[model samples]
Target: MIERDPLAPSRWSAEYRTGEFDEPFPWKPVLGVLGIVLVIVFAHLELQSKRIDELHTAINARLGGELEPLRGRFTARLSTLRAWLELREIDGPKMRAADLDFETIRSGGLLSVRRKRSAPGGGSSIELDSDEFGECLGVPSTSIARIQRRLAEFTPELRDEIDRTDHFLTLRGMQDQLDRRIDALLPELSLAIEARFLLLSEEDAEARELMLLLVDLESGQEKLRMRVPYEGRLLTARVMLDETTRAKSPGSIALPTELPKGASDCAAASTLREAIDGRHSIGEPMPEGGEHAAE
Candidate 1:
């Protein structure tokens, strides 16, 4: 081999030229691209965050301004309806008792009396006075009239049923017939009550749905909690009405197989057959031997 000159450039001189060091490292171009990508990602994220904040603000404003007021009105109406239902339940028994007392007085059975005494010789003597029999059965006419007026306040169907009951019949058959009519009417009354409740519940459901849409906006949990009591009242009223409508036994009444097509239009007929066969006490028991009559 020929001797190599130490000062001469080698075959790999092009690959390791001084120009590579004179220029900047290749990392600068990669770093610039990376910085540009980071800026784009940050800007995209900020835009999305701002849009979400704006949506939330709109939802909050609507909930506070319009939806909240509407919800309050629904709540108040539902509360009033619940109270009225409770009053009707309590008054039912009182009205029935008044009817029974009035029937007892009008029938003349309450007025029949028989007195027995030991005779001077040995045998017992019997004395019958029809007029003086139930002197104690003097239930105030005002009381009976008051009950009649209250019964009229119920739905037209129920008021019509009370009107059809024969007031001139004797006490013996009058009480039984009146009771039968009442038992038959119970189911209709229950259905009427249920119809009203269902209407109210539908309105309440709409309000609740609107509230759910606003959950992410603000006070969502608290608003939902506030609805619980109103919902409970509605459920309770429905349960009681359903129970009355489905009863199969005599004392417990039920609707006919063919129910009225329109819940609000179920009017009482001129005559109602014996729907329930068993005897049922509507209110507090009369005193022993009818000594004390209903007030």
Candidate 2:
């Protein structure tokens, strides 16, 4: 109510008391700042998403470019190897069975008999025959004598035993003893043969399983190769891929690149010589260009 001095500080005016100095909370400036912040955040997120997409594309391209060719080469070589293994499997069983049969006979399945023979000079020599050695001794005496000579070379101990025995009855007893000895040896012989058969069977099975796995891998690679864009350098890449797949062996396929770790387990590096010649000396190598030989 008192008059105010001009130089003195003035008391609050009616406008100030009514909030006229507040400036409506500056909502436009605040909204503008918020918009700028949102734009910056969205821009950063967009950049991150774009980078992620680029990385994904790069990874996929690398996989298609590199892994697919390797897979193709591996498959081709594996197919060749599997073919060879199949051939071995086909011819192996009959030969092994025949050998086992011979082993059974050699282990003592034949009888041994000796008879006195009169030579052309009127001096007598010893002759031999048995159920296993010669045919029934009477019908064709010449055939019997030839068989006896062959048996002499094969079973000298049996011949000696027969010759030492005085009487035919004693020789018969010795034959029975040989039969019993054979029966006693059969179980062990059969066990050995079975063990060998199982070993070979297991080896063949492992090779087959590895071949199947390679087939699956090859199928997957083929699909991936199809997906790869055929444009640009990829066309040349495909040509090179074809060349790689045409390789006959792992050494040729992995050339200029180290073999994958599991390659040895697949037997991919095994030589053609090893497959053809084999480790065993059981039979002669199949002649080259033979119909049965794998190409």
Query: 182-205, model 1: which lDDT tens digit per residue?
Result: 444343333222221110011133
Q: Which lDDT tens digits does candidate 2 get at residues 20-93?
A: 33345777999999999999999988876665555444433433454334434534543543432232222121
Name the regions of candidate 1 deviating beyond 4 angstroms: 1-24, 90-295
Clashing pairs in 1: 107-170, 107-171
Model 2 residue runs over 4 Å out of place are 1-18, 21-24, 88-201, 204-292
Clash numbers, per candidate: 2, 0
- List lDDT for all candidates, in order: 0.28, 0.31
Measured with C-alpha atoms, the lDDT of residue 262 in candidate 2 is 30
Q: What is the lDDT of residue 218 in candidate 1?
A: 15
Lowest lDDT sum, 10 consecutive residues, model 2, at: 221-230
